[model samples]
Target: MSSNVAGRVVCYSVLSPPRRSRREQIISQLLTSVGSLREHNRTVRVVVFWLGSRHQETEDRLRSLEAQVVHLGSYEDLLHPFPGGDVLVRYPVLHKYFVLDAVLEDLGTSQLLLIDCDTVFLDDVDKLFERHADVDLAACAEVGTVRRERGYDPAYLDEEHLARLAQSLGGRFVEPINSGILLLSRKGIEELAKLRPALLEITLRLMVGLAKSAEESDFAPLVQLRERLASGAPEVKGVAPLGFPSSNHWIVEEVALWLALGLTESLTMRDLPPSDAALGGEVYRRPRSASSWIIGHYFSVDTAPAMSWCRTGQPPHASPKGRSRAADELPIDPALAASPLLVEHEGFALYEDLFGLDVLSEMTREAREAYWGGQEQSLTARFGGVGRDSHPPRRLVSAGGGDVQDAAYCSPSLKAFLESLCGLEVEPTGRRGSVNYYTRSGDFMGLHLDVVQCELVVLTVLQDLSPADDPSGSWELFPGQVGRPLPSVSTGRRDRRSIKAMPGQSLVMFGGLVPHRVRPVAAGQRRIVSALCFRAGQTALEPPTVPQD
Candidate 1:
């Protein structure tokens, strides 16, 4: 197919199934992404490439819009070169590139947004182009999603990957890039197309590296992939393997794309605003704000992962209720200056009077009212790390909602103060704010990483009747122990430090990386605190990463 008119085109590469749910998903992406783009930019054309089994109704629906639907032959046809195409057919990521390559050939020098079918454009495509007009390509950095170290099983090493990539990339060690939402200029597209052969070599090398590093019995997928490469076969079995772990396959495509991008020296490139382009598995972690979410990429179409992913966030009826927030600039310069930084540890920070304390009055009053008003639940469970070994009993009073919840969800003052101290801009997360009460004698949470949750968490002591200095009923840290450990607070290790964020004070830390817990409450003591979550701010210059959900 040839484009009659195009300055830039928003392209989607899809592999749909016959299932009703999947059809609904495709329609959702179409309705949201195409709808949003059409509402904002008419100059940009929308192109849909169907790379799997075709359904006539969906094809007709695609035709109804300005979208030019391009039907690529079935996945089996794509695997023609692979002798036993059945094995790798399910994940057509590598083959998807062929469709994209065809697009470049037909469209010639038109700029493009090459994205996955599960992705939705939350904002204008034209505005995105104008904002990054200087760059030939832009994509989110995916270093956080893929691990660079070898675990018990063989894995790719970042150091070696970068060394090899840098050699081809003019001595630049570019971090891995996610191909989910790519913004590419004409030069970028041509350069990407040029990398076809080399990228294949890199991908095969990756398969070899993983195969070489492990025993054949350790990784079945690596063994099969290695065997196919050795025999120069296109497919493993006669057909695509059923119920394959598609996640790992997608990672290969992401790494291949990263290496391919690195090989391009003629084109200028940068990272897309991370918060704006919420990549696969990250869609849920992003805060529910329109300006904050300009794009979303779902990881899977399978019922299991997709269902869980869908539950992460609700479909917003509109952009948001108000105007976009101002960028958080540091050194808040509050006249009080009461919130002094006490000490900064590895991932934890100690502050005496954090700016979030200003809301303690209302927050505490609300918590008290809610607790007395019987809008609270007494939770009793042994909460610890991922391990379920020896967890101590934990009891706490939990309640949601108050006058301060909404304001806390996106607080500029606290964000400013945190940015000043941490030296990194942050955005308020936590879609709903809630209060945790440690009024019971055994109210304590064991050490655990927040994991796949907020990067930074702020805990403000709204009202603590316990002895401020007592370690029995306050927050405590295992001090730099990121390793997943079911550590007991009763061990009395000297490294264990109980934080004294007394009434009106707060403690902030990388909750996702650091291992922390709260001590049990004393018999007569009462403690109430509210937590505010945040993530490192995303900008075109920097990458935003939320741990994979």
Candidate 2:
């Protein structure tokens, strides 16, 4: 009954065996999760429920891990109320709820923590128990859904059926919760037991209705359900008036739990702040500085490589062999080391006048003139040999194939300087440099990581014609941070750190690892920049051609 008991009890379920590779993946995840949990909480007790036929290797592994394994028997009697044939056999997720029910029936513990096997503890979770001590159930809100939007749509729900279900619960449905990481007390379990029958009935009805409706409509049942949920329905019975469609095969348990909590008068549900617990891909991409993150669910197959590397401290290769380039080997220049622009932890540097002012000025002038002349000639030819009255400038051009600016950027002295500063031997890629000429307002580059061949990128500002007070051109960098995913063009701009680069200044970054972008240019502004790409350990006179821009 004490909070200590709750902190000690950690429960998880593995229902069926997947493919050989997936099985191995699950085993690895369990080992890492249990190992990490034991390291941080010596008194932690792990309980795993096996729902189907016995997997000897898995059972032995769990035993070796000092985990108590419970094999669940036939749930025919409990699932009989649901019209579906062998619901337990058909859907493995149902096993999680049944496992909890079995545990409550047998164990004397008043509180328990339910975690998915795909998750690992990052920090001590004692605070989580204390934080939700007063609540009957607590879980993280599901991302990419209306759960956090505080409103629900009705198109996905069988409105009349949902209205009937709400009448039975004496309340309405609320925002759905993710059950990946959950905390449940004795009272909460009891509430779920009372509501389980109605939950099953409603889910069965919804599933049948959607299946029947799908035969007549073009949309899938799940899609129709989601569409209906997105409709902003009025709140009813002190809960958000939302309904769960059973067509959502994977999230039935979560839907049932949400309904139980909202329908039960004595039960309470609390949203676990995202900062405290992250699920799926969000876990791998959580910021390293997020010390408050207690549980992380690396559930997605996309995160398998990262999870393997994080757990084993090695590359996820069959041969298990690889080389690493240590950052310490790169010595920093004492004079430039203390500059704020040099982010030592992120392997980047920003320098003013990296290229001499005179060189930059001459290159900028010539490039601008060449571009303008080319435009004028094109215009004159287009107008039947008559010189055009005025000519607009081209916004962008590839400054490659032996351009003067390209030659300046690839100078021997500059290459040597960069090599010394970063302690890495490098050579320029054969790809032509990009001459971005932003002449119009709102011209912007989205955040993105450079191609793999571009180990390093040297971006030099050739010209900025914006007003001195309203300089619109700036470099935004998403530095390489631990426990964070590589930022992408789709990510919000707020996550980036912007730096204004004056003409002649250069920004050096690990192009393939760090995500960087250029801010929009304002009206009446003319900004010109050059991007030079480099590869590691290649000194050949000619390099393979690759797109750099």
Q: Which numbered prediction scores highest in TM-score against the true structure?
A: 2
Residue 53, candidate 2: alpha-carbon lDDT: 58
After superposing candidate 2 on the true structure, give the runs of residues whose Cα lies further than 4 Å from its correct spot: 1-8, 74-82, 145-170, 215-249, 287-290, 305-309, 312-549
- What lDDT would candidate 2 get against the real structure? 0.55
Inter-residue clash pairs, candidate 2 = 152-231, 153-228, 153-229, 153-230, 153-231, 154-228, 155-228, 156-228
Candidate 2, after superposition: displacement of residue 486 in Å? 12
* Lowest-sum lDDT 10-residue window in model 2: 376-385
Give a tens-digit lDDT track for model 2, residues 69-114.
8877545544655544242233345556666566666456666788
User: What local lDDT does model 2 show for residue 208?
Assistant: 41
- How big is the positional error of residue 549 in model 2, measured in Å on the Cα after superposition? 34
